[model samples]
Target chain A: MTNTIANIDKEEDYFLNLGPQHPSTHGVLRLLVNLRGEVVKDLKPYCGYIHRGIEKMCERNTYPQIIHLTDRLDYLSAHQNNEAVCLLVEKALGVEVSDRVKYIRTIMSELSRIASHLLWWSAFGMDLGALTTFFYGLRDREHILDIFEETTGGRLLQSYNCPGGVMYDIHPNFQKRVKECLVHLKKKLPEYDKLLTGNVIFKNRAIGVGLLSKEDAISFGVTGPSGRGSGFSCDIRKLEPYSAYDKVQFDEIIRTECDSMARYKNRIDEFYQSMSIIEQLIDNIPDGDYQTKMKPIIKLPEGQYYQRVESSRGEFGVFVESRGEKNPYRIKFRSPNLANLSALDHMVRGQKIADLIAIMGSLDLVIPDIDR
Target chain B: MTNEELKQRIAQLCADAVCTDTQDYVLAEIPANSLFAVAKQLQEQPDTQFDYLYSLTGVDYNPELGVVYHLESTTLHHKITLVAKTADRENARLDSVCELWKTAELQEREVYDLLGITFNNHPDMRRLLLDEEWHGHPLRKDYSNPQLIVDLIK
Candidate 1:
């Protein structure tokens, strides 16, 4: 894994731009790939195509308004991203949400993790030329979204988490539907191991396609399943638990193989973990208020605060500096996609160009998260 | 180790470094001139061994511009926040920590592109998000554009 990635005789290499519009990229991410025939001599990712100035927008908006902006950063982990801001505000003002809020937030976060991983699995299969996995993955993901729509009233961009706690109480059937979705996915996901994960073609394309050593994963600041694949314990949920994470007992998946397949397996195993978390907490959502009373206009005393949540992709951090005003003085979101994308050049330098797609797919990049 | 012990160890490493206890992390305001040396010690030292740079961001404090680096040890799991400032706003420069954390390669470039903070020894300090012909660092407080402005007064 510590193989030399020095200049590979660029005199004979040619350049190819993979995206800015390629479907395999997942968004308008362009990769400047230097290829010697089919083998990659070097790889450089060009991002920021979808930069919407969300950080700058946060400086102008009130604390509550910033939660909506964060939902756009990583739509897949919308609930968790919103939670990061809510947690930061709660910590700054010393506001304690009810036990009900804690359990509900944890449950929603896990549900979204499953939804996100399912979508990533679908796209990953498509990257390896197995389009059937796309349909199978999305079928399960839509059920999660259906549950989201029933509770949060938004399928994708859910601004459900507010300053104190969740914006609204869980729907009456939230538990029933979520349990059903979990049961269905729990039964369906293993079939994927046989159909896609066990397929010789898929295995051949992915097993050792890309290598991100534990050192490189840490040095590059890759988190979540991607970092876990390389055996780097960068899980914020485990290290610094917030909400009900400290209460739940779940295994942080880590694979020392440090390849594309390891990353794939990490996410698959995570699906089981996320479902188990929900199963443990769903039946016991403490009966209480959904949110703590917050002012219409929120203000924090001058200070700096940072909070991170384990989004489906990785660590979604909100770093805000307050000036005792409604709007924050400065805000910076430490997006996981950018940090994860940093590992690409090192991962695919010696592999073929086709492996680049497989590797990128395994990283499960949400480009909007990167561009933001 | 707790932050208090980490600060004591860092003080021994860099006698002149200003170590302040923040709510979140231990802040070590290293001198801009000795940033690289201090950073190297923080990375390679047995106790500190800050092998992971999770977040690197540039802050524009009007007349003063500073780089905020968040380092964590994968081995020990202790975290520290290192901040270095240069009052030279016209052509702000600091020694790059890209060699320490590979994640800084893209992140530092992003800071340079948006806030106009130059890294002295960065391998490739090109504009990452913006085109070659784009003008002004948009994230800076002084960089004005009517289209991009969100006026609080209005």
Candidate 2:
């Protein structure tokens, strides 16, 4: 062998920028990856590419006006984001919303959850090279969006939830359309399993990859399916039971596998759980006023109030510090995506560059939520 | 534990700690100096294992800068809020709890970026959501950038 061949440094490492604009990242997140050949030695995620300073804007806007701004963060889980703010205002003002409002809000939230997960499932499949799953996922998601449109008058960012309750009562055909969607979702879910869950290629790429321990999951504040994948039962829906979650019967999906496959399976199972919750509450919506009357000029007493709701991603928290004014002194959104994104570096280290895509897909990060 | 008991437990851990009952959880105000030690006890102590740091927020409270931490114990199913304030807004500093909870690592960086409050022991304490060369913290009450932020009369 030539001396030149022996003299080459095998341990040399190089840096690779995955995104500021890349498809696999799902958003405008930039990952600075340190690589030794194909293996990822370390990864640093650069966020705020889409940061609109939503928190600072919230301080300037009135509480009611701030609801729509939340829609822009995690647009997939827009309904849940609206609800978090509404719930905080309601709690602070001591407004007792009617049961009808509760049922409608709960149903809408679950519909949003299913829609969000469907998009994630489609995108995740595409990330792993299963293209057909995208069509199936989006096609099913349209049913829920139609239901939202008919009632809330907006498809994606409904902003249906006001402080006292929902924007208005559900539409005349709301129950019928929701039932039809549930029936369709139930039939199509098994097809999802057949297409990707059992595929040998997906199994090979997903299983035993990007492992996160239960302790690390908790320490890193990784909630939602990502935390549940590590057998960390941190489901805020089960823990606090806001809105009508306490009234509904649904299991919090937890997996002990602690890998990419586990997180994938957790979200898949959540699809059925979300449907069951809608089924339970759809027919039984109480007949009452949708919204409670409020003073035209709303002002919260001088204090800080925190409210958390289980969004599709994880625990989405809203902390409002009000100084007895219509405009909050300070508003901070404890976005689930930000907490979930923090764990990416920890999970992707030592994994191959290809597996990094699979892990990121499993995390289901909506970058606007992180940057906001 | 009840909020009262939780408040008392935290009081026992740090004598100067001021614990109050919020509508949802116990809110404890720990001095800037004792924040790290009190946080360590809350996590390591068997009775109050607040292992989950769900939310960490930086607030510019006029003359004082504060950080609010929401902690929950998965095993105990209890929650508490801790607030630590630094009066020196000009050069605000607090001990980083990223060592105790890994989630605080990025969150502390965010606090540093948005509010100009620095965490002493953060490993990678850099601007998170903004460019490194960005002029001033936007979230501070006093922060004003005429080009960036348009002031609307309330």
Candidate 3:
């Protein structure tokens, strides 16, 4: 009698710790879950287990070096992170990159976005017990990494973005390889839907589960695919059009279901949009310098600058305060992962424990990104 | 609404609120005590409905300490930046905006953990990135840890 709960027939809750090291968490994020039997009553995400104090570090590093540090935040969207800082520096400096540079950056950024989403799809599938998706998603992602490695020398960090433009010219095979990769991914993407999206078991697991209403998404400040899944329409690439985005033609995918399946479809559809963006610019890259010559040292006028980039996950904002110094006086990165992660509790409450995994998988959170 | 219109609307709401519309966002400096009221006006007032708090940070400038709140209107797609300062440096405090934007729950905790700026009425106020027994805010300009410091060159 003492061992069992007195109100088991009624309603009683107990805490279950997910982990600061579990594989399903995708990193060191520990989620404190309040459960009533098999159903979740509350979920609290405990972050910062891997927090490296990036903002504090950036406050000490020079402007150019900050780009490299950004690469470490959301490693999947490293190029996009680099672009955020570069845009801020460029705006502060008032230097215009050549059209060639803009085209190249946009193409590269799209490529990384696809790569990041693929990796997310892979890990997400694995999170939901579809281990085969790991092999397929990574198999296609490897080709994109090869392309990046050929040009940038680093696949993960890919610190190609600089203040005025990219760090180097695109490899001569950039266009041809990109076109070939597009051809392969186009034929292969539908196979993803066939394997997981259309599967009855997967659909049963995702549809109408972990519902996040549009209002709740906004109040939680969620963005990117997570918000788009709820019809939030906060895509920075379309709304603000940075780099060469305005010249390119692509649709901002939106789904009103606001369930785990909707979030799943959002990233899948983005792969098509990203492909279209790359196709529009593949052959149109202008002839010009890869980088605008810098003044040896970079500094900004005394002011506050904000730059938002559409990372694979969501809006990655960089807020820089400079008092006319080589290093920023204070640099704050408005991390999208943190904002998206904050809404997990609201989405998972009253859902089953297994549904929590599916919901968290659809959230597509990178622990490093959240921790940063 | 345009930046000028937003500035006018904010001015109409609070006579003492000072705003600087020169930067990308409509930046404003308001008294710490009036932070909750001004934040509510920015969120509930249909003309300036800033329903999103995308970013919240604490800044340590030696003797002075302050908080930065970046708000955005999801429907209108307009953004603004608000700053509130505490006269008490070591014991800095401000009203919490978690009720307005749920995202502030963790961000305010991070600010409190890193900069030692207390967010009063914060749902759960504790050290976010450090052990609960840890001492001193690591992000403060005067913060020094000889145990962790290393020479970059030499």
Q: C-alpha displacement of A73 in model 3, angstroms?
A: 0.3
- Which runs of model 1 end up more than 4 angstroms from their true locations? A1-11, B146-154
Instruction: Mark the 10 consecutive residues where model 1 chain A has the least summed lDDT.
Output: A1-10
Off by over 4 Å in 3: A1-12, B149-154
Residue pairs in clash, model 1: none
The top-ranked prediction according to DockQ is: 2
Writing each residue's lDDT as its tens digit, candidate 1 over A97-134 gives: 99999999999899889999989999999888989999
Error of 1 at A260 (Å): 0.7
Q: Taking the tens digit of each residue's C-alpha lDDT, what string does model 2 give over B21-121?
A: 77888889999899999899989988889999999999988899999999999889889999999999889999999999999988999999999999998
| lDDT of every predicted structure (CA atoms) | 0.88, 0.92, 0.89
Candidates 2 and 3 compared: the better one by lDDT is: 2
Error of 2 at A161 (Å): 0.6
Query: Of the native A-B interface contacts, what share survives in model 3?
Result: 0.71
Candidate 3 per-residue lDDT over residues B1-154, each given as its tens digit? 8888878876876777798964588888888888899899889988778987878878875578888888888788888888888878668889999888899998899889888999888988987777687788888888986456365443
State the lDDT at A130 in candidate 1.
Answer: 89
DockQ order of candidates, top first:
2, 3, 1
- Model 3, position A276: C-alpha lDDT score: 93
- Per-residue error for B89 in candidate 3, Å, reads 1.6
